[model samples]
Target chain A: MTAAADAPPTAALPKVRVDYLPMLLVPLLMLVALPLVGSVSTWVTLTVAALAMGMMIFLMASGLTLVFGLMDVLNFGHGVFISFGAYVSLIALGPLAGWVESDNLLLNIGVLLACILVAMLVTGGLGYAFERIVIRPVYGQHLKQILITMGGMIVAEQMIHVIWGASPIPLRLPEGLRGAIVIGDAAMEKYRVIAVVLGLTVFGIMHLVLNRTKIGLLIRAGVENAEMVEALGYRIRRLFVGVFVAGSALAGLGGVLWAFYRQTLTAGMGMEVNVLIFIVIIIGGLGSVGGCFIGALLVALVANYTGFLAPKLALGSSILLMVVILLWRPQGLYPVAKR
Target chain B: MLPNNPIHSLLSGDYPRSRVLGALLFVVLICLAFAPFLFPGSQPLNVAAKICVFIILVASYDLLLGYTGIVSFAHTMFYGIGGYGVAIAMYNFSPSWTALGVGVIVALVLAILLALLIGLFSLRVRAIFFAMITLAVASAFAILASQLNEITGGEDGRSYRIPEMLRPAFRLFDEPVMGVMINGRILTYYLIFFSALLLFLLALRVVNSPFGRVLQAIRENDFRAEALGYRVVVYRSIANCLSAGMATLAGVLMALWLRYTGPDTTLSFAIMIDILLMVVIGGMGTLYGAVLGAAIFILAQNYLQVLMGQFSGMLESAGIPLLPGLFHADRWLLWLGILFVLSVYFFPVGIVGKLRQMRK
Candidate 1:
């Protein structure tokens, strides 16, 4: 275990050296799907699109898995943060129509950043209140947590309707972020490329924080045993609150990206994407971040591939993936064995 | 005190004297059955019928969530299956009574099998994992139902003809009674009302039985229950099957009442959440609490919006403009959401449970 902990970020982790066979499923799936797709360019396009979608989902799901893994809270209301972030972004973008219409790349990017920041801040604040009010009392009770959080979600979605009305709001991409770039015979949407970059940056930062920083160490320790962490003189409760806030902020960021990805937002988009998010987290093995990342990618790839191959099966494909994965590894792809 | 044997207690009329709450529910059921005759309106009878269906549905959920300590979100999926079963059978086959009976039987069997499959498969993991899996499966089923447009009617949903006898034109008498027409609607209303009552009682009997006692033991502590020579998984699986079958029956009732079945109405996650709220607000383990919870929830859900509309009108008349929009009938869900959360926190034991506690 000590050796496993001390192992460098890359290569074989001693713990998974024996069971890393399941890790091959992602690549194997991609390889097998390539022939079925039958066009190199289309395959590239599908792969990029899937990766982009997966990254956006990971952004939303990472927080949920963290909160679930660390805090043991099944927040069915996480969708509200996503919806809230998307709606909050609209507040900035709605007025800054001129900036969005602008062709200048740097200025448009600047406007997008500002929207993302606002979304994160607002959602982060909301998460704090949600935790204090709806979540804190039912800390250890999973059923009540599920129920109350779901109730919180329903209210939040309705609140969105109240504020924004029932109409679907348009959130067009900035001029600089619109259209696609040709790479060989394949065309990749410019926004998707940007999303990939942003998603990777988020993942990199999370990986660094969870694995490298002192706070990350404390959090990791706390997830394993909060009492022990407190016994060792760390403020575990404060740490958890911070983690939750961070997760909510991540969901907000994801929401902003997702809104632009679809170029149209509705009140129910958050709830709609929630199933996909759960499938990702479940496939990723609940609490394991790296597993969640892989799980998200796998889900997106399967969904995209199946959508292109058989549209009717697309809706059930991710679920099928989850079931198969669970059959293979009942605990998930990378079960975090905390308890 | 009543006899521990639920059947004996029920037959002896000792149940009402001993269990005041049970007696109260019995009266409510009677009133609900004769509601159409008393009220003489379609709207009131419709609401009463809805309450009855929800009562059975919520009670079935209690069998799993409260008794077996399993929180399965697939309850609504079974409910949808039952509705779609009947709707499709009537759509393709005859709209005759035999077809309806066949549809109900097929739905019940399918629901039980699916429940067993989901329960056994997911129970291989932990409790929380099972919950998540059910959520995934239920949502998948909803999506599939919508996408399978030909048979399920897609978003428009399928509406089927009922047996001739059950149609509204089929009158019972040559003349009206108490200014209320003796027609098929009233007969259908009574049909649902009585079935709901009987199902509620059956649920009560099941929960009070030794099997239910074991389920309660599992809920209180699964590990301890297993330690006391119980196969926890097997018991949970049986409970899951039983609950799913009963929920399917409720779904059959829902389909019959609406004469329609759609993904939105039957299989939606929102309906699942509403069921959870109903169970929680009524009380978890108590069978009678299902009646209280479902009744209160359905009444509030149906009538609260009307009350809110009136209140909004009053506010508008008084020149309280902004508040009126917030209190509009459309925004009733927002208020319901708030109330649900508050209820969960403040009345964790639920209304019936709280009443029971107070009495003690």
Candidate 2:
């Protein structure tokens, strides 16, 4: 009895068996794709590209899914945050033009870091305002939220045009980040490798924070049963606001990465990728972050492969993938338990 | 009790309910009925014709978004199909009355079938899911239209010759009537007007029917409607199909009027937004709101740019930084977007709803 009492209460908790089935999907898809794609080097190149693209998409979608899960708000204007982030980076990087143009890898990295930090801060603040002004009144009403957020998107996109001018601004990659790094017969872009690393780091941090921290625990609990969490005397509203702001900031960060990848900044860039994001989130299940991650990878991989195999069918491939996945699991790949 | 007259029956007993709204509808009807004679210029007539076409389009959309509580982004896709159907037929075949007939019938069938498929596939899911799916499908359709250059003529789109009776060169009379030339253009305008009126009336009839009541019930509470033994999906799908059919007709009218069909004119997302603005601003759930909203929105779209340009100049002269640019004619959508948000918040019922409420 003394030994049992000495053990922590957590020791008595049942183990949460992680669902490994969904986790195998990424490698499974890659393996299936490898056979279909005959040339090894081209396949490797495509895989790396797909991974980088998937990471960018994951960065954009994770926040949206969490927001939907915790608050039941499908912000149609989520793409605006990405545009805002990218535009903010444009301004932030302007003063550090020397660092951007420099050959030194450390200087280039520093410039990128500073640009990302500023974008996150500005977009985070903007998100707070957006949640307060645009989203607060429409809380608990999904229809109005979708309509109002869409209006917000239209206004924000126009504002971007007004501020940056309508013409597309060319964004040059930093000297150290440009070009490709050869891995055997295959070559991967330097920026893409960095993007993969950054994406993995973000995912790791998110996983750790969500599983280990008290705030993260509260957020997870809130997602499952918001009223129950509130009944337990926790301020779920404040937690939601925090999540909203953080989601916006993450979207902004993703936007910066996406802009660098394209190297062209258009006002509609955010909106153009919006359809893909919607597809990703829907396929991942509306409210699950891990599902969103896998969904993004699946979509990017299918898109890249099909783009190589049959360019005409590339755009339709993702939609087809969504249809197939939905048929398999109507609630999405990893349906949130609440729904 | 109201008189059992044809006009009353035609209106389906769903009157505007407000004296002011009735008067406004009457005025719009009169303006559209005699648009060519009343408006002497080509631009005003063009605006009038556009108003007529959009009234039908917007009203049909109201059936889904307002009455059924379904938001679909693929409405424009069906509209494009109708336009392309007519455009392609007329392009391939000789400019004949049969060509027009064949084109319209084929388009109506295609639009209805596509709508049915979309409804069956997506209406089973949540409204948000349906909206996103429609959006994806619509964008894909637009891309497909553009990519299939030989059929759709790619980005520039296909411009085909209409029948002789509708061409601008064909005159009804040698002499000018009431200072207006009696040409095919005027005939075409009249064709559009009469068809719009008939279609609008048909829509009104449908909405006031028992089926429409079921849709409204479903819109109010789907679960309750289901509990009450109404097949909610069936009603929604039917509403979707009917709305698509009407939108397709409106597209046919537009194609006939323009003599050209392009992705920009028929299927652009901007036009979809415009439709939404008209629905919200005019008043959702009320068909009459579509009439007012479409007319007002189109008028503003045409004339407001000039007003905005002057406002921008005034702001520039005032040395107000950013105000000038914000008020630029090209940025009219920004103002409209703000209005849309405000309207959704403050006037969820919209202009017609407000007017009717005032009367009550």
Candidate 3:
């Protein structure tokens, strides 16, 4: 505050102060829903389920939001990476089915990690190729970018059919990861708990890396003003490519988790998830990860609660949430102040 | 020739050699109108009618994307609305011609209102934001349409009957005319032909009118257009409404043609992608390009699968196991997607724009 007050007139720098107001929407919503839900146990189960779901969504969305914020490119084909990740995880899981069926938690966890590693690597590599072959030509051209990326996604999805066959393949959860633990009359799925943990870990790591590291600073700076970062003699394009690759990897991670959560995978699964991902990103504000985290939670919680309360409105609830959010803050809940 | 005639046709003098291209198109359209008799089959007429419908659809898209420079993913929503409007009206009321007329009017009105609402709500946001908002809106509508099974028939979709006079079995003549049996299908095909042509002309008129130039100006430099005293938001909203209304008209025609309305054909995002591909492949900001793009794309979409099937059959016969499986007809989307990307990369201005550029 003193520095801001004492700052020279010519150097009126915008404060990087954290805004906590939007964060309150999450707790406020939870509190408001407690009475409507009535049963404490049901509310607990729903809340946990929503949190788990929100975490997975946040993991999926964080990458696209970063890419959009920093690179200012809308890659409508982002879903292909998610699909790639989910499909690639299957390859690792196929031979490891024995290990996955094991009663030993260590072996099951090991197989899952290996699958994640392989999925992330494959998707990250594909993301590199996607950028070079599809995205590179249409830089600064949003319309072309959208059309061509969609084309790329269509081709990729078809390729999935060519490889995986045109059928929805079911995936089995690891033996140890099955079933739920009851706490004080509230039942929480074991996998949901795992998901919540993994989601938080991802969020923490992302928040730390984005705020604490040199690359993170550059990314933040780039998001604010790429031209200035370029003028400062840094190769911002390489950083952007790295960001795109990272974003793709995150999407892949989310995909593997999502596949297990649903226990199924299909060629068009990514496209279906694409709609929800965009909704989350929009409600969170296009470029802000914190906003994305909160937005994801709000959307997921609302969806689960609404689904439980009024089954008919389940699908439309998230959309209604977005509309209400946009109505209140057209730019989003945590819109980055500038380009 | 008067070089500066104000009453020139829409494409006239817009590009070098455009008048010749326009004349060629007129001839092609005339030939297409008589295609059923000439070809002596419904297949030719069906394909031509489809092309005509898409020409109008793609042209209306060009108005939004090409002229106004807005990339809306919600065009299919309006298209679906138009389809559902007609389908529901006919399903609930009598399938009389008057009901069809009422359906068209209601669809158009509904489309305009929805477009206005969407435009006013999201138009203030940045370009990408608007796209995202529309995407959200479109997906929501699709789910709503599917979930509202009573009205939409859920995933199975709803089929409605057309007027008896327009049915394929309806006889127009008791005797053959010039060795050709005239039936209701032929009449309906011609109806599609003329309506599509009229709609295309109307689209051309809108794009050629001074109002369209303002849209172009907005596309180029919106702030500058506003500085020059144009109400940018109002014009944009009107463009949205016009584009939506036009799409709705196409939807109605499609419903009448197919006698069906459903989530898959009407509200699916896949259809939205198809429209985007048509507009982009045709050329942005060039009205004539829409016709060319739609014709080529629809032809390819219909025929490419057959071609792939034949190729795959040969490969299988030749004992190429893995390759044959990969080259099935159902995988046509893979090829279409690749072609879409290549078109954007190689022919960014689209076919007409490329020709115009070459002529210049």
Candidate 4:
């Protein structure tokens, strides 16, 4: 006992346990609170909308958090991917909207898949170029990275404004999800339900991929110590590119959902909402996948609740929560690493 | 060493004391006092006055960044806070001597308290995390201000009627040019300029003083400073607080000059970037760079637009429609970003340092 007393305390290190019980329970709690929010059917509609918004937030925050946690690079222009996806989908749906207008289901499905494919490819290419050209140069300097990325954000925004013009184009939803589903006095959009269901499915798949795959192991290891991972001769540069592309792809998917949900794709929306997304990431704990979901839901709730409580004070609540979380847990609720 | 040591020379030890500064300032002031009349009704004077105000802001920013080696993304927040303080005071109460005075005092107090809070947290973090926190807080503050419609005036931004100036027992500027009294753009410009000049002198004194030397020492080697009796964090916080106080003064002046305060004026990204450009271009970490930078920036803004207008025909002939950039319809910041990047990459010492180096 005396000899063992010389050992250093292991308490300094945080033991990570990745069972996602609390995250699962969060949604369940929301579902339970639904009746209290409104009538059962009205609750259903809001719940669906809330869940859908939550998923989009989750996807955006996940990629952002992952990159920031591992690379210590804040990708300020990340919202561009989502906008790109929306634009790509919007263009694809341009002609198909007419078909949908005529009640054609077959054309709509084709348009949806084609749009996602184009968006994924375009955004991936963009992510690849951006990673190599802009992001790679200012690797070690955070200030340079921020200034440069901010410049990129401005450039991206302007480029979008130039192409799309300064108008909010209605995102043509499929005729199938056009109107609200009436459940007694309460009505909710079907697209909102779709967004939640689709987002969750993606989340499940992402969870499996991260937990089970070989690339997942490398990524997890890389997140732990990027330099050491590189030293192990594992094509870490390629990994960085791949991760970036994947992250951008997730943002693109989010953009498609955003188009349908918001029913509009505007240039300024990317930057405006990106700030809140950043807050979500910060509060969620940078780089943690589950944390992003939790953070997104929390932010969504704050946004929703604030509007209900006092419409004038909507933005107030988000900041209030962020400040509280920051002061309480400076590293966030579940910080990725000390660095 | 020959007749003089290089270390002494390197410090740029040529000091222009009280008499020299007094004469220079007197001549400059006299020239400036008359220049408004010379300009007659030139809009450029208005622009120049605003430019001076921003110059003060950038210089204060340099105190934190270039001098102390601290990178604060939220420096503009202090400026905004000061602006808001003045706006609230004058807008709610009638604008008067008492109102502006009370506004400035309150702003200073708030700046000190905020600086203390931010500085305390700032000591616990470094680099990107620090940058993130500042940026987040700044954004949050702006958003919160926007959301608090009742007090802050929300999205449309609250406007206070120009406060009546109480006659200070006797009239000071009875028949000032471009006005019946000391108010409006030209007068506000002078007010900002003189305040900035005094503030610059104050900042210069801080840099040259023992406290300034200690700060530089800490910047160069924080561990060594810590190893000594100095509590590094406390001094850093003090410097930060001082900078914030100065910025608050600037903000109060802004509210006065603009005659209104809103989110646009208070929480403007363009303003933030402009201040940064001023610091970087003028020769950051130098006593005189802020003035040089601001002068250059304003000149560029005015002259660049003129150049573009003059070259419109040439651009048309060259089959290139003038893309005057995105800052305004007249000017743009893409050019500024390019200039900032190049300056950082190359002549990072800025105009003043470059000139000194050239002299060397």
Candidate 5:
């Protein structure tokens, strides 16, 4: 019995070491190696483009992952906040009379920063109002949440259409960042490059907030055990509102980026981008911010690949990716462990 | 509206009360059968048919959702498939008796096939998982339809030339005899209207059966029902298939009536939501609720815009275009949102559910 108890720990060991990230990184490396393949797999270009798009989606879904994972609200109306932010930022500088036109590089940077700050604030406020008035009554009930929120989504879009006609409003980017910059075979838009950078920066900030701050600690604590948090005397409902607002504001930030990147805004943009956004969040994992980030980028990369490589299968590719992910890992590639 | 909730009264062993309700329902059916003569306006008749078809849809959906407590968002996908089935049969085929039978049977079977594929992928996950899977599958089907421009006619959809229905007209005797003429707007309305009536009755019978009682039992508590040896997964799958087939029936009939088909008719979120709204508004978990809900929804929508326009003169003179402010011009989303808030808060059980409860 003693000899049996002393059985080697190495007995259960498998033949191969499973280094998962590099396994993932290999497909990614091969993806980059494609352009070198004489453009034979032109579809690879779309993958890169999709990866770029995915970055923006990741930011939106990052906040949502936390909110939905913690709170049961469907938040289908989250797309509106992004659109609203973009429009608000556009209005702040270009359309509204009180705003001064700033063509100088420093002033332009100031305006962009101001836009981000104000957009986040305004969208957060809107989220608070929505949660208080519309979402509060139907917290636990799933059906009511779905229907009521869906209606809110409809109202948000309609309001946009009413305010700005159905036509796409072209946004003016203060002179300097209009065209593409050639960077060794792949021509990249300065605006899109900025978007990718901003996305990473926000992700970093979120990690700091989640890991370092006291409120973040509470959020982590609440997400793990709600009853325990309430027992600890922290306001959980207030936390939910904060999360919803913050998540919604993140969507707004994405919208602002989308507006600048696209240099145009349309009322229908929210609805148009909705399916893709939700798909990213789902594939990324329901509750994990990091998962949403990767999922969004992954979807964008896949979409871009299909568009560049096989235009015929362009739209279907993301859906196919979603199907494969569900089959392979139903919970998503990077599900979050409890806080 | 009834005096109180029918469920409460029903629980108190008010057995005789249901018989009276049945007799009243019988009378309503007789009147509906003769409604064509009273409502002679072509517009009303056409609207009636459209309403009836939608009612059938709402009723079928309620069986899966309201009764089973599973919200199925891909009901319209089945409806779209049904449209394709009928259109394919009509276009590449004859108007022979065998052709119509083949078309109907194939549509029902194919609907079940699509439902099975969807159920296999989605049934494991409830709530958001189920909702998303259904939405994704439906959108995929819609996208596939649009992408296959040649087969699906793409965005424009397919137009079937329903050659002749000599055999069909003969069976009805008083039916619109000609093919193009019979299916022409006026006659199409009656055809759809009658078919809707038939499907609604079939739906009613199913809802009243012991199977429906089982469904309700599961809805109230799946754990308890499963504990009693009921296979929930199979039951849910069966309900989904039945709903899908019924939704297809409506879609096929509409394809026949409109003589045209488009993904917009069946693939849009609007269609799915509209069916849901109708079921809720008419009443959930009740057969008659669907019929009433559809009638109100389609009619109100058809007339409401016109009613809004009527106020144009007064508003225009007062320096407002009316639509810009109220309808929010291009965005009706605000209205939808507001109404949703109002409905959830004010009419939790929906119009039909409220009225039925009152009757009790």
Candidate 6:
């Protein structure tokens, strides 16, 4: 797998070939969409909106893909974490109403950061308990895992209704985050810009951590072959638990951003987004983070463009995209090796 | 092997295998058969009809999940198609027997075709992939149904008239039989009960046939089954189509009985979850479990809300904290969810499996 002969003699690094084909899909899709969109201003607005939505999705989906890659557990209840995160933010933001309404940008940002932090913490703890209780028993059995996790999802969703009163709660954006910035002819919401920035930062950190750190290396290796990593004397189980919790926390973070973007909250909102998330991960090739990011962007772009172009076909667009991609690539855009 | 009787032949030689289960099945059968006469109320009759419909739905699901070991979230999609088909046909055309026949045939054909396509496409992948793909497709279909307001009646769904024979105004006689009115509702109830019974027996026959053995073999180990030269994909796809067709029939019965076809009634994910719970709780891989599971679940769904309300009231008066909220009538599903998860972990064989195990 490694080209040792072509490697530089000085450092003796393995010459690994990275597949950049999937990486080019995001821009390629955008360029293809531009003509169909007709107007440059509308195209720019849709593209930015798509990017913001894609980032939020990536935040939620990255952890899920990682958990699946490292350990073959697809938690159907992952959406529960998203819903819980959003609700936690509701509770957290209740006391910070003043900060939310404040005229100062810093206070507004602070309130959001505080909400995100609280949500991440609460959902992360929930993830730990869920992993131990619900998922630990059916590790290798895919059927039971799907059933049990679905059961867990139903219970969690009902619990949210019991706690949240089964009504849609309205969430108002901060003073500074409201309104839009007009760039040329296109107008972009301030919150969308902030979301894009936050999503990018998170993605950047994940990229560095997964590529540069020892733990990242272990996770990658474990995803490829857990038994080999364990035979090498590493605690793959512990690593899996950590990844699961972190993935849930990321979902929570995404939930917070998604709630603010919508300015409303419902118990089923997480579930509503879950279909898109699954499509994203599948398109990206389950377990590949970079592929998931691109997949998210592709799905979001298609959704936005279709919603604007043909409102009726918007929902089916992503599924159509998945079908075409699967037919072409079979596994996904970037299939994980040995899976 | 020893006895050649009509009952055994009807059941396809698959007995209850446990006295308690056999007794339970008999009681359920009698109760459903005499529901209108014994209960003499609309509510009880409604619950019985619901049980009848669910028995078929859950049994068909067992054919895929329990027997073939395929976990699909698209079963309800086919069910919805059946409901919508009948609803739309009756809505558009005359409320005649031709409309009913046309609707049933169209729905059955559509359901089987869709099931085959999904099976052929996703069944080739891992079970997990199939599950996820079905979930995505089903959810998309739900959205489409809700969005297409003109045709589907949108979120409100369509409530249309059935044939004159099935409508409640039609009467068989001027007098009451055994203190029960001989109205069209009773006729409809009998129609559902007979159809459900026949369809359920057909499912049992399918699961007991040689084809059923191949499904079980594949479920146990696909590689070994493939080694034995049984085309695994073809068998699984056929199983998928069969299950989908049965579920569609159950939906058609439901639409006729309810006189309505709505997203909440037929296409909701909640119903899918309910089907899963019934299959797992009653017993997987056992056709008879569908009967018991559907009965228990429908009864709980109809009656447990009242019971939960009472418990919540008592807890509230006693000044308990979250206990009352947890036991509130709307939270009935929480208990079922917990029960379902526990059953999967502890009683993977479900009630039928457990009862038979006790007998052994």
Which one wins on DockQ?
6
Q: Estimate, for each residue in B1-360, the C-alpha lDDT of model 5 and write its tens digit.
A: 353776433323222134444454445455455445656555766676677678788888988878887777788888988888777677678655477668878988988988887777777665576676677667777888888887778888878765354222323344534332332444455667678877876776666667777788888888898898888777778888888999999988877766778888767777887887777666667766676677667776777656555554456667775353564322333454465568667876666556545667
Q: Considering every candidate listed, which one attains the maximal TM-score? A: 6
Sum up the clashes in candidate 4: 3
- Show pairs that collide, candidate 3: none
lDDT of 3: 0.87
Tally clashing residue pairs in candidate 3: 0
Tens digit of lDDT per residue, candidate 3, span A286-318?
888899999999999999999989999999899
Better-scoring candidate (DockQ), 3 or 5:
3
Assess each model's interface with DockQ, reporting 2 decimals per model.
0.72, 0.77, 0.74, 0.29, 0.49, 0.86
Task: State the DockQ, from 0 to 1, for candidate 4.
Answer: 0.29
lDDT digits (tens) for residues A1-339 of candidate 1: 798678677865356254566668779888999999999999989989999999999999999999888888889889899999999998888778899889899979988998999999999999999999989999888777888898999888988887888789888788998889998999999899999999999999999999899999888887777788999998888998999999999999999999989888898899889888988999888887888899999999999999999998899999889888887887788877775
| Tens-place lDDT digits, model 6, residues B192-292 | 99999999889989999999999999899998999999999999999999999999999999999999999998989889999999999999999988998
Cα miss at A143, model 5 (Å)?
Answer: 2.0
Once superposed on the true structure, which residue ranges of model 5 sit more than 4 Å away at CA? A1-48, A95-114, A172-174, A262-264, A336-339, B1-36, B92-103, B166-187, B320-324, B327-337
Q: Candidate 4 on A1-339: residue-level lDDT in tens? A: 786577686646666577564366457656656655656765665666667788888876677777876677888778788787788786667655666555665665556667777777887788887787678878876656765676566566656654566578877777766777777877877777667777899889888888899898888778878888889889877887788888888888787777777888886566656777877887777777777788888778656645654676775677777777778777666677755
Write down the DockQ of candidate 3: 0.74
Q: Model 6, range A104-183, lDDT digits (tens) per residue?
A: 99999999999999999999999999999999999999999999999999989999988888889999998899998998
Candidate 3 chain B, run of 10 with poorest lDDT: B7-16
List per-model TM-scores for chain B.
0.92, 0.98, 0.93, 0.84, 0.82, 0.99
Candidate 1 or 5, higher TM-score?
Answer: 1
- Candidate 2 CAPRI assessment class: medium
Off by over 4 Å in 2: A1-11, B1-3
Residue lDDT tens for model 2, B1-360: 365987789899998989999999999999999999998889999999999999999999999999999999898998899899889999988778898899999999989998998899889888988989988889888888988888999899999999998999999989999888989989999999999999999999999999999999999999999999999999999999999999999999999999999999999988988999999999999999999999999999999999999999999999999999899999999999999999999999999999989986
Error of 2 at A6 (Å): 16
Query: Model 2, range A113-153, lDDT digits (tens) per residue?
Result: 88789889988999999999999999987678888998999
Estimate the TM-score for candidate 3.
0.95
- Compared with the true structure, what per-residue lDDT tens digits does model 1 show for residues B134-208? 988998998889888888999889988888777899989989888788788788887888788788777777887
Q: What is candidate 4's local distance difference test score? A: 0.71
Decide which is better by TM-score, 2 or 5.
Answer: 2
**Candidate 2 residue-pair clash tally:** 0
- Please report, in order, the local distance difference test score of every candidate based on alpha carbons: 0.87, 0.92, 0.87, 0.71, 0.71, 0.94
